[model samples]
Target: MFRFLVGRLLILIPTFIGVSLLAFFPIRLLAGDPVALLSGERVMSPERHAEISHQLGLDRPYIVQYLDYLWKILHGDFGVSISQKQPVLDQFFQLFPATLELSLCAIIFAIIIGIPAGILAAVKRGSFLDQLVMGTALIGFSMPIFWWGLLLIILFSGILQWTPVSGRISLMYFFPSVTGLMLVDSLLSGEPGAFKSAVSHLILPTIVLGTIPLAIIARQTRSAMLEVLSEDYVRTARAKGLSTFRVVGVHALRNALIPVVTTIGLQVGVMLAGAILTESIFSWPGVGKWMVDSVSRRDYPVIQGGLLIIAGLVMVVNLIVDLLYGLINPRIRH
Candidate 1:
């Protein structure tokens, strides 16, 4: 296990280098100039444009700029956002908690609802319940996140007036951002109604973000369970006169979870990708929305840094999932 972990960590070094190279070079090839975008609607003279480019190192050769950026990255510097004029890492850390909170809630919602639905569908293979569950999962999987988020806003916010249209919490509640997560910060504030307000605001976006992962997890779980149920060990458990719950839940589900867990791990990347759309639609003030706005303004540092960081996060999650395989099935530890 120790050697396995070391090997995985060693692999990440090159993986991150590749990710950095991919992130750095192509973005420079994009048509828009960050300095020009930073000037907004203003028309600058040639001399001023040249000065600004020189100041920002845009006048430097692409290879030179990339090497300098790579050196800075190695020294824990992501550079300042060309638009925001603040450190990219600082802005990212400020916004990341909100994204983390949303993603965590979304995944939890998916797991709680999806896994049981899957188990029931698998247990009752050809029954109506299975059909209904599978049908819903299929719909969830097929739906576009942006379209679904907008529909929810139209129904819940526009028509019913049940949920907030955008933002993390009601502006009525003021609290210092301890964790940068509205839900946690609200509770930490010790103010009246803040927690409820935060939760109310979270509902629509959470549902929108979670729906796809829930569908995928449910489908994976059902498939795994069906395969596991046919194995000799499952039949042996049933023949031993163990309760049906024990046979399915303990024997079948545990074995089935190996693949399902892998699917769940992969869903983290999906959730982050979907959050880009969901956050934009809802104006949720997370890293996804931040990155999107940066793209429009051609904020090179934020774009390159955010992509590299997010890719690194996905790699870390995959590593954790690999480690979890050993815990779930000891044979993998070898």
Candidate 2:
């Protein structure tokens, strides 16, 4: 297990380098030059352009600039965002936690809703309940997140007035800002009102972000369960007079979870990507929205940092899922 982890960690270096190279040159390929973009109208003067280029090290050869960027990355420096004028890494740390929280909540929502629905659908097979579950999953899979978010906002927030429309908390709450995550900070500050509002804010976005993954997981779980249900072990359990629930739950579902686990891991990354749209709709101030704004302004550092962070997260999740297979089914570990 240690060997596998070390191997996976080592692979990140080259993978990150490749991603950075792709991110770096694309900015250069854009319609305008970085120096001009930085200096704005002032760069219209040739002398000013030269000064701006010198300040930003654009005067260096392309290879030199690339090497310098890589060197800084090795030293844990992601450079500053040209637009925000703040350290890119600093911005990433500040915003990534919110995105992480949103992704986690969505995945948790997916698994809690999806796995049971899948199990029930598989167990009931051709029953009306099975059809109902499958129909719900279909609708979830077909709907785009932004549209769903809007519909949810209209129905839940606009019409019923059950939930707040935007922001992480109600303006009235005075919670401590420890981690910038309202739930955590609210609990730390002993502010129940803030906690409630935070949870309320999370629900709509989480549901919208979770819907597609839940549908996928449900389908995968149903298929996997069905396959396992017919296996000899399941039949043996039934022949041994094991309760139907035990035979299905202990024998079939456990074995079926291997693929479900993989899907759940992959879904974490998907949820993060989907949060871009969801966050924009709800004004959630997470890494996703930050990435979108950076892209619009051509803030290369933020864009590159955000992409690298997300890609790194996905890779880590995949590796963890691979290791989980070994633990869950010991045969795979060897």
TM-score of each: 0.95, 0.90
Clashing pairs in 2: none
lDDT of 2 by residue, 1-334 (tens): 7776677678877887888788677766767565566665552789877886787787888779888987887788888887778999899889877887888888889999999999999999999999999999999999988899999999999999999898888888885578877678877888657788889989998898999999999999999999999899889999999998898889899889998998898887788789889999999999989988777777777887777777777888888888887678777655
Lowest summed lDDT over 10 consecutive residues: which window, candidate 1? Answer: 325-334
Error of model 1, residue 65, in angstroms: 1.5
Count of clashes in candidate 1:
0
Error of 1 at 273 (Å): 1.3
lDDT of each: 0.93, 0.85
The runs of at least 3 residues in candidate 2 whose Cα sits more than 4 Å from the true structure, single-residue gaps closed, are: 1-14, 31-44, 59-64, 330-334
Per-residue lDDT for 189-270 in model 1, tens only?
9999999999999999999999999999999999999999999999998999999999999999988999999999999999
